[model samples]
Target chain A: MNKQTIGFAGLSHLGIIYSAASAARGFSVVAFDPRTDLTADLAHGRFPVAEPGLDDLYREHSARLTYTSDASRLAHCQLVFVALDVTTNDSNQSDLGPLEKLLAEVTPQLAHGATLVIMSQLPPGYSRKLSAKLADNKLRDNQLFYQVETLVFGNAVDRAVHPERIIIGSDKVGADKVGSDKTGSDKPGEALPAHYAAYLKAFECPTVLMRYESAELCKIAINCFLVSSIATSNTLAEVCERIGADWREIVPALRLDQRIGTKAYLTPGLGIAGGNLERDLVTVQRLAEENGCDASVVTAWQRNSMYRKDWVLGRLFASGLLQNTEQTRIGVWGLAYKQDTHSTKNSPSLALLRALNAYSCQAYDPVAKIDAGQFPHVRVCDAAEEAAQDSDVLLVMTPWREFASAPLERLLPRMRGRKVIDPYGVLAEARCRQLGYQYERLGA
Target chain B: MLQHHRSPHSPLPRTVILGAGGFLSPVLQRNLQAHGATMMALGRSTIDLTKPGASAELAAHIQPDDAVVMAAGLTPDKGKDTATLMANLRMAEAVALALQHSRPAHFLYISSDAVYDARWSSLLNEESACEPSDLYALMHVAREKILGQACQQARIPFAIVRPCAIYGPGDTHNSYGPNRFLRSALNSRTIALFGAGQERRHHVFVDDVAELVRQCIGHASTGVINAVTGHAASFGEVAEMIAALAADNIMIDHLPQSAPVTHRHFDTRALALAFPSLQATELADGLRQSYAALQPASGLAALSSASPASQKPATKKEEAVCP
Candidate 1:
């Protein structure tokens, strides 16, 4: 199949990575953004996000990647990716406004038989609703595909450049629906048209084709399973600490077992903080309640996550680290929920900071910036060493690779006190003990 | 006689048992009886637990000072069908509603070790990932959440007990440890083993489970605990012990090894916290007692008369249910 022009609408995080990756795969890419300033910035190779290696890839393939605010440029492409990170509410509920707005702008300019692939994390059945809306507007069958996006913040370039797998959801029944209108065809050896096959063939990654609901559900199910593992692991880690058994040792043996492999997301930490797992749980709960399915299982997942999220605060209070020290200065390293992303949305570290009674607190992130007014007492430092300077206690909230690999000997000298709470156990316990630092870590 | 510790102001504590006719019910009943405590035992036949009014009716039946033990639910079977999952979930909802309505002093849920996906390790303690493979384990996990929420909302003390491979002489479900061996040895039959029989299992006698539950009832321990033997034994060790205790002519057969089944054989230190003085029967001695108990007049004659072919060696399917 011959490659066709692929358009990317709303050049946000998802759009830039996907468009760049597509362009790198030799597809002529037309990237669109409604904001004139953003498009102008992109044209001069100014990327909005601080993703590692993304800017270099953008620079290398900027020739094949066309950045524009014009909707007419999309008409030249046969396939379009409506890529935008859906905005989440305070309750972790997603607002589909950005997605709907982009769809309204792009659908009108789409050429006949042009496939619209939605590359965003959405609620279960959201894709089916989009498919129905497209069908109601008289779009051809299989013209709309809901493809799942698996991009992580720090590793966006690698995830996009080499994804684990590509999943495509289209309503096309067989090969006959590819390029031509064969509504009444009864032939056995017919092939889908090149135009339709080209949309699927454009992806160099292995594609999983399923129905709309299944594809939408696939994302939620995976997240739910992952969250369940996290919650269970956290629960066990707490038990392990109380029983004086190292959960770290237990987790490896569990991982080696084929039924519970190492990749089951069973790592114990300060619970789930990022938006992906939380959004999926809430989505499943909402949809289950709406459809009258037994949602109690998902609700448990949510409750467990909430309980585990407060684990750091619970540990700090229980350990007496925050007691008798009203004016204690606590240094926290890594503000993002997990390593490698600048996003602090529903971050567990920030939540822990909010619950701390200490009057003076310092925080540092590799890429994330804290709003001055949001955290009145938190002083945002430039680096990890600066954050630990003159601090009564050090709390390693996020397990960013830099902080994990930082020389503890150099950083520990700056702090006044010896208490270091590393939720991820970034520093070796034996080494920390040798340095005479009072160290506490999760699942130790 | 055991000394009783009572609160000065409160009245005598009462307790209610759901699924009172189960394998652990008799021991629980005897323990409660020994304490001279007021208690009520309800079986599924007495109340259709899946119905909407079941909880309300049960709450109305029990007094205010009473606690509720939700031990009633579908056990894992060969089919591991959807109906079993739905039934267990309904049972949980009913128990949660009852606890919510009655505002019990304590809500004790008897969960299973099967909730932990066996793939992780053999000696899973209280803290382990709940990776349930079949619907049975899934249902138990789901129930743990439903009841946990109800207890939280009602401000009642809640305790979840996840027992590992419970076995003893009274287990009519010949699938449990002692009964399976006794039945196989008495009939001079070969015991079909899954895997290399090297996968270890931490088996808790039924009486120990009863003691743990009684301790939780009396002490109001409000978290999850693993009710299991501290020691783990492989199937081969168990079979050899049982064979030696038999009529001396019984043959032990090894079946072709299949893929290992992942299960949580617990480390019961948390349980020991509540019942520090509780004694567990040694595996060999327990097998001997089980063999002796299976004598002709001990009422296991019917089981013994049933051929080994009828017994089917208690496959992994039977393992889902308690031994």
Candidate 2:
């Protein structure tokens, strides 16, 4: 069988990884980025996303993959993946301008039989509405499909290469037709095309072919479930400690049970970050309110997340770190929600820093520079040691690789105060104690 | 299994099983009983280890020569929640303090593989540098350190066991290790997998863990040891075995990998060296035992046999309210 040509519109982080993975899988991939500079840079092997193995994958599959600023390049491909990383605001509302612009530019170029799969994380029903709008503009009903993108920033290459499952939401007939053609031919009385099934099958993952709404809901549902678990875990972890029960021991057993498995988002941390879970929660609550569904569960999830997000600040307040200390210099090691990603959308570290800035705060991220333009009071230092210098309290927020392995002896001298609040527990307690630093870590 | 008998009138060797209501609590209780050891199963209801002075309070109850297994901490329930993670850490600190004052003969801590970060190549052993990804792991590392230091200062025996993916019979909370596969199989539900099932894992049966703890009680081994099966099994193989055992054509759906890739494989050589003759139950046999244990007649019989009137559900109003 001849290999299929896949085109990715909007060469953002998702596009870069997905297109590279497709090309790695021996498919002819054309990646179109609206930004000419980015496309040119990518052509020269410069990647926008700081993902492991992505640059290597791009270099290895450079011949099979093509980067272009030209929209017309997508016309030749059998499948088009609208793979843009949607931007989320502080309120967890997604600004779909990039996606909308990409869709508007690429919809005109989509061929008659071509399948357009929206492989971007969007609010539920957003894709269906977009598809309907495109259909109104004379596009066939089955031509467009909405598929959820499940790419973690640091491990985007792995996610793109091997997705857990692929969900496609479109009309059934269109999906069947596309799937049938791809799988040679449909059997007698074969299930009708699940409009999204064809697009999902194109990715070669376990396909969940459903209606547009369900596909959208499926994505949000997964995030909601994760957020819920995170909130519950965070809330109960405190209770476990307070009650003398070990949440860690309870969690393993919980994970062992099928109802809550090891994969369930149960690790207690700085709460939800990267905008995915937050966005889903917001979208779910919005949809629930609109449809008059009981959104209390989701609201509670959000509240718990917000509460847990401020947990560090709360600890600082409770620990008397901020008491009577007017010029308390707080050093924040990480800016992103988790490590290896530059995204600070709804980052808990930033939230804690904002609280600390009420006094005085110094922050340093290995990748992200704290924008002085946004927070004029905050100082963005060049190095972790520099950030710790003269700092009254050191908050290890993001579990960055560098922060985890940083030498304590080097950091200790730079720190003005002995109190170290390492939520990620990057520094070993034994070493911390040996150095005579008063340490605070979560779940220790 | 050798049945050792102790006179009922004679007091059994006092053993304090910390976190007695935990997943391993029942098994620990049973194994201790089999060993003719008196067990005090301390559940969270009786203790709040995260509170200030919890350790001092716990120490007041501890008697010299009593074996205290610190198996308590905040486990990952949903994902990483910072507050809960901190609380678990605090509990560990309390446990460490208690260990300091009481000076128990044996301090066995149950740690998780989460303590090791993704930088680990091949199977991580006991000597692996503690680079925890999540807060729970971080706290465990902290707790282990605090206990280790206390043990060193007090000159007491301390054994730290880090188990990876423990699963077996009598696992009620079914989300970790092989229980996820078994639970899905039992429910006739689809088991969704993330990424390729290629990430190596060493799943030890809970019974094995219980036995390992029992062996660690009087063993000369000190410091950290990976308490797991010395073999790595792919997620696909485990899922398939569970499906086959279930006799149901359950679909194993591979989903996109959203979380960080935690390629966990542990070397149990240190554990073996510590507890010689400790044999891990094979994954297949363990699954078979787990599958059989999940039977309604076998697993739920105790709960079911109790009169309905005897079992009273906690009232919504009576639920512990979080601050």
Candidate 3:
């Protein structure tokens, strides 16, 4: 067994996964969260997040993991990670209050030589500000590092266990500012604590070392690239609808090109939904506004995302199905932002539902629980077909696999109307069209 | 033939390959060899996977640190019956059973895009649901599951490559895409299609699939990837592409439409993310290379004379099928 004892403070999605993965990697881990109930549940193999292989990973390595709510429990560790999932507000601005409080509580209790790595989504200068504040507590500047956490919501366990690359932003005592024009090689990771370096080496991937600001901004940079791809796909998909072309047909040609590569965000969907990407875009726009830099592209992406979010609404208006509010009984399937996630923050389904609130709406989601009081106009159904029953129109909002594989014959008999507006193409258009229903999908 | 050969990179460990006589194996073996891999290419003549006790024989061949490629199976052209399905499952069973005994560093299983539920006409990725349409597709799905479970039990790094309508020279199956188009164009100076050939399907060059396998072996990449060009072309378009390189007087015929014109598209983000350096062969360029490979020393004359295989009449099932 590895002698290193790692500590994770702030046990949210990132902390739970990384701490479990650390324990699986043979390091004894102390998972500390402020919520006592969460820690108590985690001790019994009950994870708040529903990730595949998470329950089993925690169970298999239960002997090596310790779940605690006490901040003082972190003092016994050689390396500590501030693994809080940043909370964002309506404007996509991060509320760093929880992260700030946790750091304040955990910093004074950290072992003298222990390396404190911030593994949260941070703004460009947050790490440097933290380093400056912690200097008063006698925490050595070289001992502070910021590691980018690239864990997706649904696929966190696997990514946490086997990262593609480990990007660490070490504190270069008096390095250049956030956006320096100077060019130089990245700093070496030799300043990292031996235990911390050894823990990263176990992953067997490349370790990229840079200054605190770059590492802080790296997460945002990656998300911005993804947003750009999504914007590109969404824009072209709309064009495909106008012209006699299929965006799906063009995706392959683009993917084969080396410049575009295979994994480009080529799938057209209801714009940027989840909180993280939106947060990064808003941050970029804010940074540009404050720095007096031009961010026309970012502004365009934001506008495009807002426009695309109402894709289902656009189709509904075009069809004039919602013209007679009393006659039109709309069935909306999928409330989550995306499939396999319970979060409904900025969900396009909710956006569509809100637009149709004047009309009677029935909605169903496999996992996401809808508060009955939040939308008095909508009825929450137990099953997908239940939501479709007796409705004049059915809108398959989220492309859940269950929604895709649901038998079309079942929906054919239950629905009162023949119009099916599926933005994500969850159901087969050919099948729907053959069944005497007017089926419409994105990108022609 | 215009080709871009992969340069020598870091040499790979010993690789044990099944299905040596298949069209893709030889090309894959060559590519792996170019990358300095010591290959033990096993064919049915050496170890028939459908026979009993095949697992024991395979187990004895595998060693620690060797990358094993299980590409042996009955193609749809061979037979799409339950008998063929069972035989394919048996092949996978043999490989799975062998892996349980002798663990390799990495295990790769060759699957097909047929495993994906084709009813949903959206872009498919690795995460796409595996709802097989037919027994042939189901056979691949079953084999993948069997091998995946076995690899997991043995703690072996496992990957699955599902290629969409692979076509190139030396292809024996001759699925109703580029391969059959090229053969009909050469032998009869005619390219036949079903229903105006409007159903667009993605086709990856056999060499590109081989290159992907080489990279997977080199990097020890684990997870599922679809070996596709991401470019779906209509059968008419593909026929035109092939005929452009063939004789100018070649005739194009559209037969009666038998089935619905369903299109298949792919989201190959996982493929790009896994092998960023991999360059997929363009369909037009790939067809050109395939056409050149089919040419005899005397050029199209030898094939035009109608060999016994070429003399066989095209079956109704053969011309209508699109996979």
Candidate 4:
């Protein structure tokens, strides 16, 4: 650990969390970003985003960690990771321009023999193209590794530090690569160099080594599977609601079936909304279209997500809750995509607000990075109580804990109407109905 | 008597393998054996593919429920000369003649990526052209036609798997691409590439190809499906990767090209469509495993004596290790 220097070129979601985790694991971590403000803030352990336990990790590992805006700091590192979180546009299309530009800048500062790993979640074949662009350089293919980033937005810290398993996209370079390294042809001792071995040794977890494309696709495959599971749950959960069967009740059956397992994404909610899944779906669609192949399944997931996002709106209209919307004052409980994360890239709450822009709405988010002002008229309230006050119907979009403790029982008698729209089933439906408030939820 | 087990839940399909001593043969046998599925793997020693009515024994060997995996064929290196073309044709005819009598539930043909024209197009899939670039490809194409018809007439579901450059541990075929690239990375530490090494080609791990063939045993998927990962990497990309894995001290030497660069990429939509649950092993993992497995002195001997290399080399010895 003392011999190896782990360097990160981008200090965003992937960079900061990983560097801090690497530092905590007893390795010297040097994190860099082009933005001076971000780097300066990171140096003081002030992360911009709210990831659970991230700040604590940074504070604990700050002594061994160095935050820099200069790329040259990477020149001395034995293993340098290009960990930029690739941004996506409105249509969920990935804009890799920033990641490519960062790689171009990081390449020149790369120390001779330094193993450069692309730790970002880029599209399949992007790494091959990135490696191809550096063909003129003295870089070796084995050094150009792509470790698939499977960090969840809300739980980046724990997921970054202690991953379930590490999947590294790598290749064997040079002449001796054709056959197995153990084929009685070469010396038996550690054939892998000390520097490279040090990098692998630091992982401290079961690691899957794959080629660049497979590594890249594995990320999408995993996300796509999650999306499929979510879609299946949501689609069937909707059916369960109509047929008088609870999805939560059916979950145990699915979980007990060893094939689906207990950890399957069987929870029913307002479809898949995270940008990563959507971005990968778009990528698959684009890949299929370019190749003149069928991507109907991916397109179906996208369609299902869009349809499920409107579930709240659909229920409102079905229950005659949206009648006289010009005078209806709606209260939105949460706005951030999911719990404990400030990212609202494809938050269903924000989508509901946009759909309800025709009506008067009071929105309150416990930790909102999304500006509710985009809805062109919803009033952003200070607290959960204010949003719930004097509302015709209260819509619980995101399941923030603060909303659950928002004194809903006390505020129920004060509202103009008693309709409480909770898509996530955050509050007890029987208690709300017994308190003289009309209760609603998804999939019963 | 065959080697396999019987399970009440999901019975391992009784299987018959045609080319048991081919490149993908050993891995296929190992995987099937691990599943405890009954199988009969026939090689040249068990049955000569060149002889007339060589397939007559297939009827008696095959059971009604048995699936056959045809992995037997001469590779480009072995069949590069014109003298080997007749033997290749004779081998295909023998397999077809054998399948005529006894119809198995499934028949899988281990085809080649060389059947697609690299000059005319780069992106090859199940729908690509049938023009073969060399005699080895021509033989595979011809074999597919003959065997495909035989399966079709027998009302049997057959799969044609055309795998691109296959590289793995115990691989004897030391081609210039991944095979040669790996050898160059280890033996020389300085990888030499043809020209700028810009030619994009597909290289699937031998185990991955075996897994694809295994998928066909129980599956009813028919027609031509290229067993590609849709990850076509450049020769230079491969060189750079090896150079890095070997060490930072390694060098990449770009040499002049003697042959025209043929860019071969594949759209693996068919493979995806056929086997939705298959987790294909990635390239880096395969390379690392292969490298690690083949690291010790004479590491190739680690294979159980049942491996194809034990009886006959998977690929002819590469007299010239690298260019």
Candidate 5:
């Protein structure tokens, strides 16, 4: 099982993490992408996504990993996972064209009895139909499977290495049953296909076997629960602001409740900015509408998300600091949506900048680069303090940990005015107030 | 065995029963075992169909040559709400998914007579329209379609048995039918009826339904067959029959009707055509057997003139909505 080669199609974040982790697990990995430049960059240790320890893990396991643009190379591997990060349109609907094209290229090259696992986000019923379609092409039913990927953006490496449970959707009955070995393996007591089970055994986690549709829906169910938690926090945090209560103080009590455990996404933030959450919400809404399932709650989530996206901008307009906007140079800290990665899709910082088009904005982020043409009135600064220079107001939007340790005394001299709006409470509130700055934050 | 037993047919194939915890599954399991067939009964403890990985768990136990019988479902006694319906559908989904992967040689789903249009006044057959009046019936209708489609796609021979109100010893539902009538006679010595129990419904014994399942497996049958006795007796008549069979004098009382009086009659020609030699037990005899089987051992010695030797074991049936 350890000697079996694993193949990954598509060089998205999901593909990179799984490929690197597979290599780290001591199995030879073939990571393929049709894009030659992307494959070349990967081979040269240039990754397209950033995650803590991702580069180090890849560099250390480089000897076991193969980055290639050739589909034929996957034929040598016994198990392959289609780990394409589903691309979404502006409306958050998944565009499955690339995934279909990738499957078309890779399926023909797969070895006989090679397992094909889809680890991408998919609409329900898609996997079963895909299995049928593949069966039409003479592929055995057991050859195809669906696996739910639960990788988080900033923590991809850790999640890849340490999944709480591995959910593999297979048509083969008892494929996930413990101590069951009915996969027609000649070897005694092999539950799943010997190669597939061996690959999963490397993870040393509970493996769940289910139908493709259930597994596909399980991924959406996870995102929906997360969206629900975020919506709950944002709604309650708004109520706290009016009643003189601190959301941070209430979080501890909520965490103690068994129903709402420590991992609950209770912190209120600028609505759902990343495409993943919004895409799931939209998918649910569409599924509900199509099936006549009442999804009023899903609609409410979208409304809440839209209202929360403008939290920073709404606070800015409500404050009189923007009254003399022509004379004001605003300092904006952070551009990426909630940090750790460079993606800015539907970012609240960008939304704030777009709304403050009349003013000259000075922004500095540790990584995320802004498009100059999109925000012509904004100037990208070299350092956090440099953005504060000659600025009347400062807005700490993304809660990057480094921003918490910024020198307060140095910032006081750099800033022209004393208004500090830190929605995430990243900086010290007592120090900002003692420095004679008007510190405004959500939920008191 | 009715339905033209394939002469020189192979012995009963290995049978895997899903929803073995339900009232009828165990009975069917016993019948298959009695017929010298290989049986794997998957009760809730073995594999809960509503769980996350149930499909895989169920598929693992089933073999390519196995004949699978899916008799697991929630009755109206649980609830008639959408949630219950979804739970039942989830169970069916698990079976359908498992069948797709397992690709068994034969698949049979135990459906209900409730799937027929509640408004149908004429004799119902397999071709009758399925316009279920409630969620429980709708769940069965949906399940039949789900399992039917999966079997068709997998090329597995599929059969459906939509039995009428099934009543015998060890009945769990005790719905407003013969089961309830007999239990009331024994427990309280008072048989209560809704609006004089005027609504007539077909009630088949549990054993008969199990026999149909056995024959269906033996013949590798396809298509739908109603597991009915071709007997429609009013609730009042069934109560009276139980009262006659009981050792103690059972008083019959009529309560005000909650709904309008309705009666269901099934055309069992298909059942006859499928299993030509199989016979459904007469209602009077079934009530006598049920009354005797449900009585306590000490009470059996003092039983009424209804002799056990004079009666035969009854047919197995499904649930009929109460009026």
Candidate 6:
């Protein structure tokens, strides 16, 4: 019996969770990164980041997993994954230079006939460009693959282990048939080798095998659809706010339809908040300009997101809460992009804070890293109640569990003002109104 | 919880309709929709009711407080064939079994006026004796009994609607009296009548039938109702009304009849008693409306006013009935 060793390159957010999940599924896994400190932290059983249940899984499967900074340690692996999360600059531009530099350094030391799978999210033609470089070096053409990474920030560990489906961008036909859309590509250098095929079976999920460009484009297509829906909901939600109708009551009818199921992304929110969806939109527009495909819908989504980012400021202005800026005290409950974890890339609450740079603001996030250097006058409170203390108005920006479960009957008396503007609708509006706090939400 | 998810704001129920691609089926769907009802119309293309286990598949589509209209059936003029009879029987059984399994909030079966005995010349009402005259009538008569028994046992609130001869837009049957007369007036500028235009029968507008169905479903009714205009007209009067609404140059060709002249009249007193708000459309008004709705984009009523080929009248089977 031959034991297939799986290797992951770059121990970032995408790399750490997937490596730990593969080890938990009874596969011998090896992950390597050139950063010695990050590798040392993982080798000593300290997680490089925070994800729910990630540390426990790593402890249970630590005997089968290896962490190293040496590229030669990946030579014995049949499938070596380059699973780096591409970072964005301060201008929100996708910086692919780091991923390209890492891929160049990791592909050369691989053993003969070992699959070099690029698991990082790539633009449409990036997969083809990298595969062309691998073929130029007399490497076996069948060993190149680009697998799409579908990791949402908060649910990384669970999605890594129990994926809805796996998309392998190679022309390999496995023992079990892949998804219905998997047809053989007419292009060359798209087939997967026997070793990579057997190694991917450890995920125990339905696999989709297609060409490199198709796989790369499929990931963008899914995100574009999701962003369009979110943008549409926000657009209509603004109309509902002006009119007397409630978007929350109307959305359930749409969700019950078979075309849009109960799990549809129909919530009216502060627009597309994370880096992944925005990056995909930018990538789509770039590709569309080169290919001349119609991309007006993507432009509309980006414009709507920018328009929704100023919702908090608009509400405060309309309520006359920010009129006396020198005396008015504002409390912001959460600063993370969403409810969990410490990632703040393209966080809407941070955008609101930046817009309110002239006003005195107090904010709190239980776990998210706050850069005090960005705003000099704003105070970072340790507790959520401290932020809400002596406030003319309180803004519930993020929907953390503590914000929803807090005893508002006991806490509202501490605030100086009797107004709460909650966009998330996490708090009960009726009870808040009964408690004599004037509440304002997006829709009804 | 199911009601919470069905329709949040609309007090009207979500309705599921079978055999919903036909002419009357779509009009009924539109009529109910305008009243704020959420509906799903399934045709044979969606689920072949004759197929085995299709009943179970249909049962899964129903929800609490949802209305189900079984419009699935075959008309006699589509002809006296065993396939037509058997298909209608199977659809009746499948729909009944589905109702027994799901027990929809309201069950409505689109029965026909053909269930009345043709032997009696007097106007037939809901309480009239049902005597199947042929294989086609026999099919509806058997279906009525099966559905009546199945709905009773299943504890489903069921209503049956027996509509008379219907004429309106999208009448593919192009039946003889009003549909063919309008088509003839448009295509050839001529109205072809059978045997001195003397057959006396009841004609109901397609929209009226749809309105009756909508009202029945809304009332959550459990009884039989007839869809008809209390006033019956001779074929000659219907042709004159079409000719008058059409053009000055339209001609009427009185052709020799092959069969005996039949009089089928309906007493719609029960329809008025069931719903006092119901208004039966007049013959001249219904004929004019049907004529205005049927003129094609080719200007058949305007330019092709004298074409002789348009004079050939459509068969009576093309005369209107819904399956």
In model 2, what is the error at residue A54, expressed in angstroms? 1.6
Tell me how each candidate scores on DockQ against the true complex: 0.02, 0.01, 0.01, 0.01, 0.00, 0.01
Which pairs in model 6 have colliding backbones? A171-A190, B173-B318, B175-B318, B175-B319
Clashes of 3: 2
Q: Per-residue alpha-carbon lDDT of model 2 for A226-342, expressed as tens digits?
A: 777888888788676546775667778888899888688777887778878888888888888899899988876775676567667656654556644357778888888788887
DockQ of 3: 0.01
Clashes of each: 6, 56, 2, 48, 16, 4
lDDT of 4: 0.75
Model 6 per-residue lDDT tens digits across residues B203-309: 88888898888777766767888888766789998888888897568899988898888788765445544553456667778777677665565232432243332
Stretches off by above 4 angstroms in model 6 are A171-191, B1-323
Go through the candidates in order and give each one's C-alpha lDDT. Answer: 0.73, 0.72, 0.81, 0.75, 0.81, 0.77
Summarize candidate 6's per-residue lDDT along A1-444 as a digit string, tens digits: 227788999899999989988888778889999999999999988875767888789889898899999988898887899999888776556789999899878888788878888888887778777877788877754377888888877788899988877776753444353343322231221245666656555565666777777888899888888898899889888789867889999998999898987877788888787788988898888888988999988887986787677677666654556546478888888888888667777888888777666578898888786879997657999988899899888898888888888788877777999999899897778888999999987766
TM-score of chain A of each: 0.91, 0.89, 0.94, 0.93, 0.95, 0.93
Worst 10 residues of 5 chain B by lDDT: B314-323
- The ten-residue window of minimal lDDT in model 1 chain A covers A180-189
Off by over 4 Å in 2: A173-204, A324-326, B1-323
* True C-alpha contacts between chains kept, each model in order: 0.00, 0.00, 0.00, 0.00, 0.00, 0.00
In candidate 3, position A76 carries an lDDT of 91
For candidate 5, write residues B1-323 as lDDT tens digits: 13333441579888887765566765786787777877777767678888899999889988999988888877787677888999999999999999999899989899999999857545677877899888888899999999999998999888889999998765666478887777667767998999889888889998889998898999888888998876688998888888888777999988989998888987654654455446677788877777776656624322222332232122222311111
Which lDDT tens digits does candidate 4 get at residues A170-263? 5543334322322222221133456655555555555565567777888999998999999999888978986798888888899999999989
lDDT over C-alpha atoms for residue B97 of model 2: 78
